[model samples]
Target: MTARAPQFCSMAWAGRPVAIEHQWIEAGPSNGPLLVFLHEGLGSVSMWRDFPSRLCERLGWQGLVYSRPGYGQSTPRPLDEPLPPDFLERQALEVLPALLQALGVDGTRRPLWLLGHSDGGSIALIHAAHHTDSVAGLVVLAPHIMVEDVSVASIAQAREAYQTTDLRERLARHHRDPDSAFWGWNDVWLSPAFRDWSIEAMLPALTCPVLAVQGQDDEYGTLQQVFGIAAAAPHTTVEVFASCGHSPHKDQTERLLDLVTTFTGASSPNHANI
Candidate 1:
Protein backbone atom coordinates (compact mmCIF):
# COMPACT_ATOMS: atom_id res chain seq x y z
CA MET A 1 0.00 0.00 0.00
CA THR A 2 1.07 3.57 -0.68
CA ALA A 3 2.01 5.76 2.28
CA ARG A 4 -0.47 8.42 3.43
CA ALA A 5 0.18 12.08 2.82
CA PRO A 6 1.00 14.36 5.73
CA GLN A 7 -1.86 16.12 7.52
CA PHE A 8 -1.82 19.79 8.47
CA CYS A 9 -2.83 20.71 11.99
CA SER A 10 -2.77 23.64 14.39
CA MET A 11 -2.50 23.79 18.17
CA ALA A 12 -2.76 26.55 20.74
CA TRP A 13 0.40 27.38 22.62
CA ALA A 14 0.93 30.34 24.96
CA GLY A 15 -2.60 31.44 24.02
CA ARG A 16 -1.74 31.62 20.33
CA PRO A 17 -2.50 29.12 17.59
CA VAL A 18 0.62 27.68 15.99
CA ALA A 19 0.45 25.72 12.77
CA ILE A 20 2.21 22.33 12.53
CA GLU A 21 2.63 20.19 9.43
CA HIS A 22 3.34 16.50 9.96
CA GLN A 23 3.56 13.13 8.17
CA TRP A 24 2.97 9.84 9.96
CA ILE A 25 3.92 6.37 8.73
CA GLU A 26 2.65 3.35 10.57
CA ALA A 27 5.14 0.51 10.62
CA GLY A 28 4.39 -3.22 10.53
CA PRO A 29 2.20 -3.37 13.62
CA SER A 30 0.13 -0.97 15.72
CA ASN A 31 2.06 -2.12 18.77
CA GLY A 32 5.38 -1.18 17.18
CA PRO A 33 7.43 1.72 18.60
CA LEU A 34 7.46 5.36 17.43
CA LEU A 35 10.32 7.60 16.30
CA VAL A 36 10.09 11.36 15.75
CA PHE A 37 12.37 13.29 13.41
CA LEU A 38 13.29 16.87 14.30
CA HIS A 39 14.93 18.95 11.59
CA GLU A 40 17.85 21.35 11.63
CA GLY A 41 17.86 25.11 12.27
CA LEU A 42 16.68 26.15 8.82
CA GLY A 43 15.18 22.81 7.80
CA SER A 44 11.63 21.54 7.41
CA VAL A 45 9.91 18.23 6.83
CA SER A 46 10.55 18.34 3.10
CA MET A 47 14.27 18.78 3.53
CA TRP A 48 14.69 15.39 5.20
CA ARG A 49 14.03 13.52 1.93
CA ASP A 50 13.70 9.74 2.47
CA PHE A 51 15.97 9.46 5.50
CA PRO A 52 13.14 9.23 8.03
CA SER A 53 11.28 6.57 6.13
CA ARG A 54 14.44 4.58 5.52
CA LEU A 55 15.51 4.76 9.15
CA CYS A 56 12.08 3.70 10.38
CA GLU A 57 12.11 0.77 8.01
CA ARG A 58 15.55 -0.29 9.20
CA LEU A 59 14.46 -0.08 12.83
CA GLY A 60 11.04 -1.61 12.37
CA TRP A 61 9.28 1.41 13.84
CA GLN A 62 6.70 4.04 12.88
CA GLY A 63 7.86 7.56 12.05
CA LEU A 64 6.58 11.07 12.69
CA VAL A 65 8.14 13.89 10.72
CA TYR A 66 6.98 17.46 11.29
CA SER A 67 7.89 21.03 10.53
CA ARG A 68 7.71 23.41 13.41
CA PRO A 69 6.04 26.81 13.10
CA GLY A 70 7.75 29.34 10.80
CA TYR A 71 8.86 26.50 8.54
CA GLY A 72 7.72 24.38 5.61
CA GLN A 73 3.92 24.67 5.20
CA SER A 74 3.45 25.69 8.84
CA THR A 75 2.12 29.11 9.84
CA PRO A 76 4.37 32.08 9.21
CA ARG A 77 5.67 34.31 11.95
CA PRO A 78 3.98 37.69 12.37
CA LEU A 79 5.93 40.55 10.80
CA ASP A 80 6.11 42.65 13.96
CA GLU A 81 6.72 39.77 16.27
CA PRO A 82 10.11 39.06 17.83
CA LEU A 83 10.68 35.52 18.98
CA PRO A 84 11.74 35.18 22.60
CA PRO A 85 15.25 34.15 23.62
CA ASP A 86 13.60 31.01 24.91
CA PHE A 87 12.19 30.09 21.53
CA LEU A 88 13.82 26.66 21.76
CA GLU A 89 12.60 26.38 25.32
CA ARG A 90 9.04 27.21 24.24
CA GLN A 91 9.28 24.46 21.64
CA ALA A 92 10.36 21.97 24.30
CA LEU A 93 8.20 23.01 27.26
CA GLU A 94 5.05 24.10 25.47
CA VAL A 95 4.77 23.14 21.82
CA LEU A 96 6.06 19.55 21.84
CA PRO A 97 3.72 18.20 24.50
CA ALA A 98 0.79 19.88 22.80
CA LEU A 99 1.78 18.34 19.48
CA LEU A 100 2.10 14.89 21.06
CA GLN A 101 -1.29 15.22 22.69
CA ALA A 102 -2.91 16.29 19.41
CA LEU A 103 -1.36 13.27 17.66
CA GLY A 104 -2.45 10.83 20.37
CA VAL A 105 1.11 9.85 21.36
CA ASP A 106 0.82 8.59 24.90
CA GLY A 107 4.37 8.87 26.21
CA THR A 108 3.60 6.70 29.23
CA ARG A 109 1.96 3.90 27.30
CA ARG A 110 4.35 3.48 24.36
CA PRO A 111 8.06 3.97 23.68
CA LEU A 112 9.15 7.18 21.92
CA TRP A 113 12.52 8.07 20.45
CA LEU A 114 13.78 11.39 19.10
CA LEU A 115 16.16 11.77 16.19
CA GLY A 116 17.07 15.46 16.03
CA HIS A 117 19.53 17.56 14.05
CA SER A 118 21.17 20.92 14.93
CA ASP A 119 18.76 23.33 16.67
CA GLY A 120 16.22 20.55 16.82
CA GLY A 121 18.88 18.52 18.65
CA SER A 122 19.21 21.19 21.29
CA ILE A 123 15.47 21.34 21.75
CA ALA A 124 15.31 17.55 22.00
CA LEU A 125 18.02 17.57 24.65
CA ILE A 126 16.11 20.10 26.71
CA HIS A 127 12.89 18.14 26.38
CA ALA A 128 14.51 14.81 27.26
CA ALA A 129 16.17 16.39 30.25
CA HIS A 130 13.01 17.96 31.65
CA HIS A 131 10.53 15.27 30.63
CA THR A 132 12.77 12.37 31.54
CA ASP A 133 10.03 9.77 31.65
CA SER A 134 8.61 10.55 28.22
CA VAL A 135 11.62 9.87 26.04
CA ALA A 136 12.97 6.35 25.51
CA GLY A 137 16.19 7.22 23.66
CA LEU A 138 17.70 10.15 21.79
CA VAL A 139 19.88 10.37 18.68
CA VAL A 140 21.47 13.76 18.03
CA LEU A 141 23.46 14.82 14.96
CA ALA A 142 25.76 17.87 15.02
CA PRO A 143 24.00 19.27 18.09
CA HIS A 144 25.22 22.49 19.65
CA ILE A 145 25.47 22.39 23.42
CA MET A 146 26.99 25.88 23.47
CA VAL A 147 27.51 28.78 21.13
CA GLU A 148 30.89 28.98 19.42
CA ASP A 149 32.66 31.59 17.33
CA VAL A 150 32.95 29.04 14.53
CA SER A 151 29.18 28.58 14.42
CA VAL A 152 28.63 32.33 14.51
CA ALA A 153 31.02 32.86 11.60
CA SER A 154 29.41 30.14 9.51
CA ILE A 155 25.94 31.60 10.12
CA ALA A 156 27.25 35.04 9.09
CA GLN A 157 28.58 33.57 5.88
CA ALA A 158 25.20 31.92 5.25
CA ARG A 159 23.48 35.28 5.73
CA GLU A 160 25.71 36.87 3.11
CA ALA A 161 25.21 33.97 0.71
CA TYR A 162 21.43 34.20 1.07
CA GLN A 163 21.50 37.91 0.15
CA THR A 164 23.91 37.91 -2.81
CA THR A 165 23.25 34.49 -4.36
CA ASP A 166 20.52 31.97 -5.24
CA LEU A 167 20.57 30.48 -1.74
CA ARG A 168 17.26 32.14 -0.97
CA GLU A 169 15.73 30.69 -4.11
CA ARG A 170 16.93 27.23 -3.22
CA LEU A 171 15.54 27.50 0.32
CA ALA A 172 12.22 28.88 -0.96
CA ARG A 173 11.40 25.46 -2.35
CA HIS A 174 11.40 23.98 1.18
CA HIS A 175 10.12 26.80 3.37
CA ARG A 176 6.59 28.15 2.92
CA ASP A 177 7.90 31.58 3.96
CA PRO A 178 11.60 31.43 3.19
CA ASP A 179 12.17 34.84 4.72
CA SER A 180 10.77 33.67 8.06
CA ALA A 181 12.92 30.55 8.12
CA PHE A 182 16.04 32.42 7.07
CA TRP A 183 15.71 35.50 9.23
CA GLY A 184 14.29 33.77 12.28
CA TRP A 185 17.23 31.40 12.28
CA ASN A 186 19.85 33.91 11.10
CA ASP A 187 18.96 36.87 13.33
CA VAL A 188 19.02 34.83 16.51
CA TRP A 189 22.43 33.28 15.88
CA LEU A 190 24.00 36.59 14.81
CA SER A 191 22.67 38.38 17.87
CA PRO A 192 25.42 39.26 20.38
CA ALA A 193 23.73 37.87 23.49
CA PHE A 194 23.08 34.58 21.77
CA ARG A 195 26.83 33.99 21.92
CA ASP A 196 26.48 33.12 25.59
CA TRP A 197 23.85 30.50 24.90
CA SER A 198 24.65 27.01 26.14
CA ILE A 199 22.81 23.93 27.36
CA GLU A 200 25.66 22.33 29.30
CA ALA A 201 23.78 22.61 32.56
CA MET A 202 20.83 20.71 31.18
CA LEU A 203 23.02 17.93 29.81
CA PRO A 204 23.61 16.41 33.22
CA ALA A 205 19.91 15.87 33.64
CA LEU A 206 19.61 13.72 30.52
CA THR A 207 19.34 10.30 32.09
CA CYS A 208 18.45 8.30 28.98
CA PRO A 209 21.00 6.70 26.70
CA VAL A 210 22.02 9.14 23.92
CA LEU A 211 23.77 8.53 20.62
CA ALA A 212 25.54 11.72 19.49
CA VAL A 213 27.05 11.90 16.01
CA GLN A 214 29.14 14.61 14.41
CA GLY A 215 31.01 15.15 11.17
CA GLN A 216 34.76 15.59 11.30
CA ASP A 217 34.65 18.69 9.13
CA ASP A 218 31.35 20.18 10.28
CA GLU A 219 31.64 23.92 9.88
CA TYR A 220 28.99 24.76 12.48
CA GLY A 221 30.13 22.57 15.35
CA THR A 222 33.22 20.78 16.57
CA LEU A 223 33.98 17.48 18.30
CA GLN A 224 33.54 19.36 21.55
CA GLN A 225 29.79 19.20 21.14
CA VAL A 226 29.84 15.42 21.13
CA PHE A 227 32.49 15.33 23.85
CA GLY A 228 30.38 17.55 26.08
CA ILE A 229 27.41 15.27 25.70
CA ALA A 230 29.51 12.21 26.55
CA ALA A 231 30.99 13.93 29.58
CA ALA A 232 27.61 15.04 30.90
CA ALA A 233 25.83 11.81 30.14
CA PRO A 234 28.52 9.16 30.31
CA HIS A 235 26.00 6.64 29.05
CA THR A 236 26.04 8.55 25.78
CA THR A 237 27.86 7.07 22.78
CA VAL A 238 29.77 9.28 20.34
CA GLU A 239 30.63 8.82 16.66
CA VAL A 240 32.65 11.05 14.33
CA PHE A 241 32.59 10.48 10.60
CA ALA A 242 35.72 11.32 8.62
CA SER A 243 35.53 13.63 5.59
CA CYS A 244 32.01 14.59 6.55
CA GLY A 245 30.46 18.01 7.08
CA HIS A 246 27.67 19.59 9.10
CA SER A 247 25.17 16.98 7.95
CA PRO A 248 26.44 13.45 8.48
CA HIS A 249 23.39 11.60 7.16
CA LYS A 250 23.58 13.63 3.96
CA ASP A 251 27.33 13.44 3.66
CA GLN A 252 27.84 9.80 4.65
CA THR A 253 24.46 8.18 4.35
CA GLU A 254 25.33 4.49 4.51
CA ARG A 255 27.80 4.73 7.37
CA LEU A 256 25.60 7.05 9.39
CA LEU A 257 22.58 4.80 9.04
CA ASP A 258 24.69 1.79 9.98
CA LEU A 259 25.86 3.54 13.14
CA VAL A 260 22.34 4.59 14.14
CA THR A 261 20.86 1.15 13.49
CA THR A 262 23.55 -0.57 15.50
CA PHE A 263 23.38 1.81 18.42
CA THR A 264 19.60 1.85 18.75
CA GLY A 265 19.35 -1.88 18.38
CA ALA A 266 22.00 -2.59 20.98
CA SER A 267 20.51 -0.31 23.63
CA SER A 268 18.66 -2.30 26.27
CA PRO A 269 15.09 -1.43 27.21
CA ASN A 270 16.20 -0.57 30.75
CA HIS A 271 18.81 1.91 29.50
CA ALA A 272 16.41 3.45 26.99
CA ASN A 273 13.77 3.86 29.67
CA ILE A 274 16.19 5.62 31.97
Candidate 2:
Protein backbone atom coordinates (compact mmCIF):
# COMPACT_ATOMS: atom_id res chain seq x y z
CA MET A 1 0.00 0.00 0.00
CA THR A 2 1.27 3.50 -0.83
CA ALA A 3 1.54 6.10 1.93
CA ARG A 4 -0.45 9.31 1.71
CA ALA A 5 1.27 12.65 1.78
CA PRO A 6 1.10 14.75 4.96
CA GLN A 7 -1.55 17.47 5.02
CA PHE A 8 -1.89 20.65 7.05
CA CYS A 9 -4.76 22.46 8.80
CA SER A 10 -4.64 25.75 10.66
CA MET A 11 -6.43 26.38 13.98
CA ALA A 12 -5.88 28.53 17.04
CA TRP A 13 -4.74 26.45 20.00
CA ALA A 14 -2.49 26.79 23.05
CA GLY A 15 -2.51 30.53 22.44
CA ARG A 16 -1.09 30.39 18.93
CA PRO A 17 -1.96 29.64 15.32
CA VAL A 18 -1.21 25.93 15.33
CA ALA A 19 -0.73 23.93 12.17
CA ILE A 20 -1.93 20.38 12.71
CA GLU A 21 -0.09 17.85 10.57
CA HIS A 22 -2.06 14.80 9.56
CA GLN A 23 -2.29 11.96 6.97
CA TRP A 24 -4.81 9.38 5.87
CA ILE A 25 -3.84 5.72 5.59
CA GLU A 26 -6.47 3.96 3.45
CA ALA A 27 -10.11 3.90 2.58
CA GLY A 28 -12.33 1.25 4.06
CA PRO A 29 -16.08 0.82 3.56
CA SER A 30 -17.81 4.19 3.48
CA ASN A 31 -19.69 3.32 6.63
CA GLY A 32 -16.63 1.92 8.37
CA PRO A 33 -15.38 3.42 11.61
CA LEU A 34 -12.38 5.78 11.67
CA LEU A 35 -9.31 4.82 13.72
CA VAL A 36 -7.41 7.93 14.73
CA PHE A 37 -3.75 7.31 15.63
CA LEU A 38 -2.29 9.50 18.35
CA HIS A 39 1.49 9.58 18.53
CA GLU A 40 3.72 9.32 21.61
CA GLY A 41 5.16 12.28 23.48
CA LEU A 42 8.03 12.75 21.06
CA GLY A 43 6.27 11.09 18.18
CA SER A 44 4.87 12.44 14.91
CA VAL A 45 3.07 11.01 11.90
CA SER A 46 6.50 10.05 10.52
CA MET A 47 7.57 8.67 13.87
CA TRP A 48 4.74 6.12 13.87
CA ARG A 49 7.01 4.33 11.32
CA ASP A 50 4.41 2.48 9.21
CA PHE A 51 2.75 0.83 12.21
CA PRO A 52 -0.54 2.62 11.56
CA SER A 53 -0.63 1.59 7.91
CA ARG A 54 0.23 -1.99 8.73
CA LEU A 55 -2.33 -2.18 11.53
CA CYS A 56 -5.02 -0.59 9.35
CA GLU A 57 -4.29 -3.11 6.62
CA ARG A 58 -4.62 -6.04 9.02
CA LEU A 59 -8.04 -4.95 10.29
CA GLY A 60 -9.30 -3.64 6.92
CA TRP A 61 -9.63 -0.32 8.70
CA GLN A 62 -9.03 3.25 7.57
CA GLY A 63 -6.95 5.54 9.76
CA LEU A 64 -6.13 9.18 10.42
CA VAL A 65 -2.63 9.79 11.84
CA TYR A 66 -1.59 13.23 13.03
CA SER A 67 1.38 14.99 14.57
CA ARG A 68 0.33 17.18 17.45
CA PRO A 69 1.37 20.81 17.51
CA GLY A 70 5.10 21.18 18.30
CA TYR A 71 5.88 17.79 16.81
CA GLY A 72 6.84 16.65 13.33
CA GLN A 73 5.82 19.15 10.64
CA SER A 74 3.22 20.76 12.89
CA THR A 75 3.68 24.14 14.51
CA PRO A 76 6.89 24.38 16.49
CA ARG A 77 6.81 25.33 20.17
CA PRO A 78 7.85 28.85 21.00
CA LEU A 79 11.31 29.05 22.58
CA ASP A 80 11.34 29.54 26.36
CA GLU A 81 7.63 28.81 26.52
CA PRO A 82 6.91 26.28 29.20
CA LEU A 83 3.81 24.15 29.04
CA PRO A 84 1.46 24.20 32.04
CA PRO A 85 1.01 21.19 34.30
CA ASP A 86 -2.41 20.85 32.70
CA PHE A 87 -0.93 20.40 29.26
CA LEU A 88 -2.33 16.92 28.83
CA GLU A 89 -5.73 18.17 29.96
CA ARG A 90 -5.60 20.94 27.36
CA GLN A 91 -4.67 18.56 24.55
CA ALA A 92 -7.53 16.23 25.35
CA LEU A 93 -10.18 18.85 26.04
CA GLU A 94 -9.13 21.62 23.65
CA VAL A 95 -6.79 20.66 20.80
CA LEU A 96 -8.16 17.23 19.86
CA PRO A 97 -11.80 18.35 19.85
CA ALA A 98 -10.93 21.27 17.58
CA LEU A 99 -9.10 19.03 15.14
CA LEU A 100 -11.98 16.57 15.05
CA GLN A 101 -14.46 19.40 14.49
CA ALA A 102 -12.36 20.73 11.60
CA LEU A 103 -12.38 17.23 10.11
CA GLY A 104 -16.12 16.92 10.74
CA VAL A 105 -15.84 14.01 13.14
CA ASP A 106 -18.28 13.74 16.03
CA GLY A 107 -20.66 11.35 17.76
CA THR A 108 -23.33 11.93 15.10
CA ARG A 109 -21.25 10.95 12.08
CA ARG A 110 -18.87 8.01 11.66
CA PRO A 111 -17.62 6.21 14.77
CA LEU A 112 -14.15 7.04 16.16
CA TRP A 113 -11.68 4.52 17.59
CA LEU A 114 -8.63 6.11 19.16
CA LEU A 115 -5.29 4.26 19.04
CA GLY A 116 -2.98 6.27 21.21
CA HIS A 117 0.55 5.67 22.52
CA SER A 118 2.31 7.11 25.57
CA ASP A 119 1.26 10.71 25.97
CA GLY A 120 -1.21 10.19 23.17
CA GLY A 121 -2.82 7.39 25.13
CA SER A 122 -3.41 9.63 28.12
CA ILE A 123 -5.00 12.21 25.85
CA ALA A 124 -7.25 9.57 24.35
CA LEU A 125 -8.39 8.44 27.80
CA ILE A 126 -9.13 11.99 28.88
CA HIS A 127 -11.08 12.67 25.71
CA ALA A 128 -12.98 9.42 25.95
CA ALA A 129 -13.66 9.96 29.62
CA HIS A 130 -15.14 13.39 29.00
CA HIS A 131 -16.73 12.76 25.60
CA THR A 132 -17.90 9.23 26.15
CA ASP A 133 -20.48 9.42 23.40
CA SER A 134 -17.94 10.39 20.76
CA VAL A 135 -15.90 7.18 20.83
CA ALA A 136 -16.61 3.54 20.03
CA GLY A 137 -13.57 2.19 21.90
CA LEU A 138 -9.87 2.67 22.49
CA VAL A 139 -6.53 0.82 22.28
CA VAL A 140 -3.88 2.59 24.34
CA LEU A 141 -0.19 1.62 24.35
CA ALA A 142 2.01 2.50 27.35
CA PRO A 143 -0.19 5.33 28.55
CA HIS A 144 0.67 7.24 31.69
CA ILE A 145 -2.31 7.69 33.99
CA MET A 146 -0.09 8.70 36.88
CA VAL A 147 3.53 9.66 37.47
CA GLU A 148 6.11 7.12 38.61
CA ASP A 149 9.73 7.20 39.71
CA VAL A 150 10.68 4.83 36.91
CA SER A 151 9.14 7.14 34.34
CA VAL A 152 10.88 10.15 35.78
CA ALA A 153 14.25 8.38 35.77
CA SER A 154 13.85 7.20 32.19
CA ILE A 155 12.95 10.72 31.11
CA ALA A 156 15.92 12.07 33.00
CA GLN A 157 18.19 9.64 31.25
CA ALA A 158 16.64 10.68 27.97
CA ARG A 159 17.47 14.27 28.82
CA GLU A 160 21.06 13.22 29.37
CA ALA A 161 21.12 11.33 26.08
CA TYR A 162 19.71 14.28 24.21
CA GLN A 163 22.39 16.58 25.59
CA THR A 164 25.35 14.22 25.60
CA THR A 165 24.58 11.87 22.75
CA ASP A 166 23.33 11.98 19.16
CA LEU A 167 19.69 11.58 20.18
CA ARG A 168 18.93 15.18 19.25
CA GLU A 169 20.20 14.68 15.70
CA ARG A 170 18.31 11.41 15.44
CA LEU A 171 15.02 13.02 16.50
CA ALA A 172 15.64 15.92 14.10
CA ARG A 173 15.10 13.51 11.23
CA HIS A 174 11.39 13.24 12.13
CA HIS A 175 10.66 16.66 13.74
CA ARG A 176 11.02 20.07 12.16
CA ASP A 177 12.36 21.45 15.40
CA PRO A 178 13.71 18.69 17.62
CA ASP A 179 13.87 20.95 20.65
CA SER A 180 10.20 21.73 20.30
CA ALA A 181 9.35 18.04 20.41
CA PHE A 182 11.82 17.04 23.10
CA TRP A 183 11.42 19.96 25.49
CA GLY A 184 7.68 20.13 25.00
CA TRP A 185 7.45 16.63 26.47
CA ASN A 186 10.54 16.44 28.65
CA ASP A 187 10.25 19.62 30.68
CA VAL A 188 6.65 18.97 31.62
CA TRP A 189 7.27 15.38 32.61
CA LEU A 190 10.18 16.27 34.89
CA SER A 191 8.64 19.10 36.82
CA PRO A 192 7.83 18.68 40.54
CA ALA A 193 4.21 19.80 40.09
CA PHE A 194 3.78 17.34 37.25
CA ARG A 195 4.62 14.47 39.56
CA ASP A 196 1.33 15.14 41.29
CA TRP A 197 -0.55 15.05 38.01
CA SER A 198 -2.97 12.19 37.79
CA ILE A 199 -6.05 11.25 35.73
CA GLU A 200 -7.44 8.45 37.89
CA ALA A 201 -10.50 10.52 38.77
CA MET A 202 -11.41 10.76 35.11
CA LEU A 203 -11.15 7.00 34.64
CA PRO A 204 -14.62 6.18 36.00
CA ALA A 205 -16.15 8.43 33.40
CA LEU A 206 -14.90 6.31 30.50
CA THR A 207 -18.04 4.95 28.87
CA CYS A 208 -16.54 2.83 26.10
CA PRO A 209 -14.59 -0.40 26.14
CA VAL A 210 -10.81 0.05 26.36
CA LEU A 211 -7.83 -2.15 25.60
CA ALA A 212 -4.71 -1.15 27.51
CA VAL A 213 -1.43 -2.72 26.33
CA GLN A 214 2.02 -2.35 27.76
CA GLY A 215 5.47 -3.93 27.77
CA GLN A 216 6.73 -5.94 30.72
CA ASP A 217 10.11 -4.25 30.53
CA ASP A 218 8.79 -0.78 29.90
CA GLU A 219 10.99 1.72 31.67
CA TYR A 220 8.62 4.66 31.59
CA GLY A 221 5.76 3.02 33.50
CA THR A 222 4.83 -0.09 35.37
CA LEU A 223 1.88 -2.47 34.97
CA GLN A 224 0.01 -0.42 37.56
CA GLN A 225 -0.78 1.93 34.75
CA VAL A 226 -2.93 -0.66 33.00
CA PHE A 227 -4.10 -2.26 36.23
CA GLY A 228 -5.26 1.07 37.52
CA ILE A 229 -7.25 1.52 34.35
CA ALA A 230 -9.05 -1.77 34.95
CA ALA A 231 -9.76 -0.87 38.58
CA ALA A 232 -11.39 2.45 37.79
CA ALA A 233 -12.98 1.55 34.45
CA PRO A 234 -15.18 -1.52 34.35
CA HIS A 235 -15.12 -2.07 30.60
CA THR A 236 -11.42 -2.51 30.00
CA THR A 237 -8.90 -5.19 28.98
CA VAL A 238 -5.19 -5.36 29.64
CA GLU A 239 -2.40 -6.98 27.60
CA VAL A 240 1.20 -7.10 28.76
CA PHE A 241 4.05 -8.15 26.49
CA ALA A 242 7.10 -9.76 28.02
CA SER A 243 10.68 -8.79 27.16
CA CYS A 244 9.37 -5.60 25.62
CA GLY A 245 10.24 -1.98 26.31
CA HIS A 246 8.25 1.25 26.33
CA SER A 247 7.11 0.95 22.72
CA PRO A 248 5.12 -2.21 22.09
CA HIS A 249 4.43 -1.21 18.47
CA LYS A 250 8.14 -1.13 17.76
CA ASP A 251 9.26 -4.01 19.98
CA GLN A 252 6.36 -6.38 19.35
CA THR A 253 4.71 -5.27 16.14
CA GLU A 254 3.41 -8.65 14.95
CA ARG A 255 2.01 -9.56 18.35
CA LEU A 256 0.67 -6.07 19.00
CA LEU A 257 -1.07 -5.95 15.64
CA ASP A 258 -2.69 -9.28 16.40
CA LEU A 259 -3.83 -8.10 19.83
CA VAL A 260 -5.13 -4.85 18.37
CA THR A 261 -6.95 -6.67 15.58
CA THR A 262 -8.57 -9.03 18.05
CA PHE A 263 -9.24 -6.39 20.66
CA THR A 264 -10.59 -3.82 18.27
CA GLY A 265 -12.43 -6.49 16.32
CA ALA A 266 -14.51 -5.27 13.35
CA SER A 267 -15.48 -1.95 14.96
CA SER A 268 -13.91 -1.83 18.42
CA PRO A 269 -16.90 -3.79 19.67
CA ASN A 270 -18.58 -1.91 22.49
CA HIS A 271 -18.35 -4.90 24.83
CA ALA A 272 -15.99 -6.29 27.41
CA ASN A 273 -13.07 -8.39 26.13
CA ILE A 274 -11.67 -9.45 29.47
> What is the lDDT for 240 in model 1?
88
Q: Report the alpha-carbon TM-score of model 1 versus the true structure.
A: 0.96
**TM-score per candidate:** 0.96, 0.95
Clashing pairs in 1: none
| Model 2 per-residue lDDT tens digits across residues 76-181 | 9886998889999998999999998897766546667899999999999999999876788999999999999999999999999999999999999999999989
> How high is the lDDT of residue 231 in model 1?
96
Per-residue lDDT tens digits of candidate 1, residues 42-127? 99989998888888777778888899888898887765565666788788788888999988887666777889999889888989
Candidate 1 yields a Cα-based lDDT of 0.85
Clashes of each: 0, 0
Give candidate 2 misplaced runs (Cα > 4 Å).
266-274
lDDT of 1 at 132: 86
